[model samples]
Target: MPVYHQPRKRIILLIITALALLLIARLSYLQLVEKKYSRLADANAVFKKIIYPGRGLILDRHNRSILGNDILYDLMVTPSAVRNVDTAYLCRILQIDKTEFNSRIADAVRKNGKVRPSVFAGLLPAAVHSRLQEGMYLLQPGFELVPRPVRSYPYRAAANILGYIGEISPGMLKMERYADYQSGDYIGLAGLEKTYERVLMGQRGIQYIVKDNLNRPQGSLENGAYDTAAIAGKNLQLSLDIELQVLGEQLMHNKTGSIVAIDPATGGVLAMVSGPSFDPNLLTGTERTKNISQLLADSSRPFLNRGIQATYQPGSAMKPLTALAALDEGVITPAFGYPCRGGYFSCGRRIGCLHSDAGHADNLRLAMSHSCNAYFLHLYRLMVDSDKWGGVKKGHARWREYMASFGLGHRLGVDIPGEHPGIVADTAALNREYHGAWNSCSELYVGMGQGKVAVTPMQMANAMCIIANRGYYYTPHFVDHIDHADDTLLRRFREKHVVAHVSDTAYHSVVYGMEDVVAHGTGKGARIDGIAVCGKTGTAQNRGRVNGVVTDLKDHSVFVAFAPRDNPRIAIAVIVENAGTGALFAVPIANLMMEKYLRDSIPLAKRPMVERMMK
Candidate 1:
């Protein structure tokens, strides 16, 4: 403050001079030493570039052909960088209305700003692109065409199994893991597509290109030295026999059930057909919306995947497991007997055997061959009635354990999704159901494979496999392996579950009883010459009563069988709903499948019992 205020003007002049000198030095450095950075910064103000990757491909197990891929394309847009564009003419050429064209232009402008560029049209067909190639000057300077890839499926029959692919929605893109994806990126939606998405979706590659002021790609920035090459997706090889699947589907045309065939030794699914299947092509592209709506509207539920999802009362097909359980538990000796006089039993009025009259007692083998309901009722009571077995078993607890051992009370853990763990009622469950009024009568129906017990056809098939394997079975699976360029990738399912908790001697006896079934009993229809076919037949009544009387509503015909009793190969279960008599309906179908597997031919006259039962 001494004379300081008067020196303010001099200080200000000194500051201006220093600033000017600093500015001159900065300009010299930018124009010389940092010229490249300055040039790039200036170039970025006028031009922009985007990188795109080619989508991966999917192939069959053999790596024969492409199942999905991308074709090169020229995507174009309109922006303020261009001087003039005939909006009306361009809209007409691009099959859009003037209003839509204007709206799109406005959106592009907002996205890229008045000085930048954006994309407006994508995936122009080669012919259309050729037409526009000669008229580039007529379009706006900011318009650009970017190459892209789309997903597709071949061999459309495996629609349900292979599933469909679709564009990712905004919500999907917002997910943290999908941050790199845009709204229109394709993703697996179902089936194997959903299952193997990670392996099938290869890493994306990119290329950086330089652009001119007009926003047209001028050339590669570094000759693509930093570019990564797109890798193709791995191929998959399924255990399914396409021919067998096709035949099964054809045979089941117009029906509403599922057919699954597995190799007993390997548990490889040979054929799986859910009736009313639709072509996979229907779910691709523009026609997808309309086709999916039609399929959904159809009452048959073509998309239900019934082969693994639907569970039904396995009916008499469950008897083999029950018999094995009884024998294994030592509750019933091979000498145990029951009589089948006519069509009723000696049990109380409320609970009578399927057969009537009280004839002489028959051995266990004879009872099984005849499917005598009374024999099983006696066995069921022996296992559950603690009073009868001298408290060796608690009420229903031991029986429940035995049944669970047979894999009846739970899911078989097959490879497919949506499998149901069928119903198996115990004392606690019965308490809730009957409110503490549960009795031996409830056990009677269960022994006969009815009332409170439900199972899936897959479970029935697995039971047959267990019996065929002499009390052990591998979990069933549909996929066998995936094929890649360098190696053959394999996925073998091999987990043996022991369903029988009995001695070897008891198991042998039970096997003998099952053999006797086809040798002389209701399952004789399943017999095949030169291939000791052994099986059991059951006809379970549906829910239809008359005046407090129970009559057959529509029988669920079921049969479980295996061939060459000494060295079993294929084991099978067949259920024909609404068909009366397992001997008439399911047995013949089982025999047909066996014949197809063994002799590779359908024996028209082999099943004489079917004809006899029909009469």
Candidate 2:
């Protein structure tokens, strides 16, 4: 019988031994080497809590806090742990009706199963939180108070620039870009907050605490060996001068336009004001949803950052680029001039000029100072019809390249978002619009910034910077430097950008003309006593439809200027929509901004003018 025994029996025994060894190894791994399964098993007796770090502070150039942190508390509830709770007493403590309380409980249970925690009431004030905390034990082991840092604006002037934070949306929670965020996390919604969200939103930490069988937290597991400490956000030091910002906002009150000022040296935004802007605080705390809804519903669109979002025809503000183009191409010179009668007549159309019949705009200085429409129109035609390029299409393409280099007809790559690249009509576009029969003369309106070219106040201000810096500019930005941040975030703005390949002499000639503008030309209203202000006034033609019929409207007042011609500190662009003229409206606002910034005070003599403009 021993000799006849089959080898199959021995093989089966070996296989059974191997299976037992594998099972023991796996069990050993589950209990010791790998902790995931054990953690799952212990979940009933362990609580994982999220620790939110403090957001960075936003300070102005003067070291004054524009936005600071405030302590806020949230009431968290564990649905499954709730028992023997007084419904009416809890509702009274939270200041919610019975129906609302029930609805919240239902929502919590629906969102995060019965065993998990959910927000019962969030962003509670210090007073309300203290009162509720004193009576928290009355609600049993279900509710706990969690503290968080909330945004608080002390100045409250830069609503559009500082931006606001809001709770993460369902869409945001699922996106890979916002993977770090949970359903209850708050994120920057707009403006600077949105731009520097990563820097402002610090890393969140987690703590694992031991709990009893009854689902009550006892102490930290293993003395907090698995706990992660929260890292604080990096603080931002902005280039904005709060005093100047307040002044600009005040000057723009009751108006329907925008003002953008920048430090040409560093491309730092000094003051940016968009009229009809609501308070930044309105978008903070618990009332954000309701406030945002109302703001969105409003017709004026206060949330619109007109400085970068709104595009205008640019009027004579664009003429400086035209002059630069002609000078750079050698089609015209600082010495070139054009004679004008009442208006310019070409291609069977008459384009009116404010500087018509004034004198021979014999040089770029006179042409730009007077904002001679005929002069620029002639220069534009010469630029696009030059024999060097052989055809208007080729010449216009060259012109578009120059505009792109000037940061026009495209986004300036500002730090914030929602910027629109203004329309710069291309050759194909021109052909499509004109049935392939267009020439330089056919698009003469483009010369005066009226046809297809558009610009934002931010672009206009940067263009002025190009002139101020003499053929080069730094990409405009608001933050001068960020504390504890690497240069990668600000390196692009620090790099110099050149435009049109124009000579320094050409830029100097343009500067001389702008100076004359403030001294004796259309921009006389922007003159400061001791400071040499260089400026260009523009009146953009506007049209709108009223009652389903197209109608002509008042011109948009536009002005671009910089002070102290030698070493320019500030460059500004002002656009007053539908106002009479740049000198009448935009000039004064610019003057006040420059004066306040330069001297730290508006002269007593300028008080009356300020009052009149305020009225």
For all candidates in order, the CA lDDT equals 0.66, 0.87
- Report clash pairs, candidate 1: 75-145, 82-141, 342-356, 343-355, 343-356, 344-355, 344-356
**For residues 1-615, could you state the per-residue lDDT of candidate 2 as single tens digits?**
575566877889999999999999999988889997676566667777889999988899999999999888888887877888776778887788989987888989897766677888999877788888888878778888888889988777899898889888888888899987886788898889999999999999999888787777899999999999999899999999998998888887788789999999888999988887878888878787889999999998898989999989988888888888888999977888677775778657887777556574767787787788888888889999999998999999999888888888888888888888888899999999999998888877778788888889999999999888888888888887889989899899899776657998888888898899999999999999888999999988788899999998998999999988988999999998888789888999999999999999999999998887787
Model 1 ranges off by over 4 Å: 6-156, 176-182, 343-347, 350-361, 387-394, 484-492, 516-520, 544-553, 564-567, 583-585, 601-615
Report the lDDT tens digits of candidate 1 across residue range 210-299.
666555566776687656665655656666666555555554555555666666787766666666687777876445777999999999
lDDT of 1: 0.66
Q: Model 2, poorest ten-residue lDDT window?
A: 354-363
- Using TM-score, give the best candidate's number: 2
**Each model's TM-score, in the order given?**
0.77, 0.93
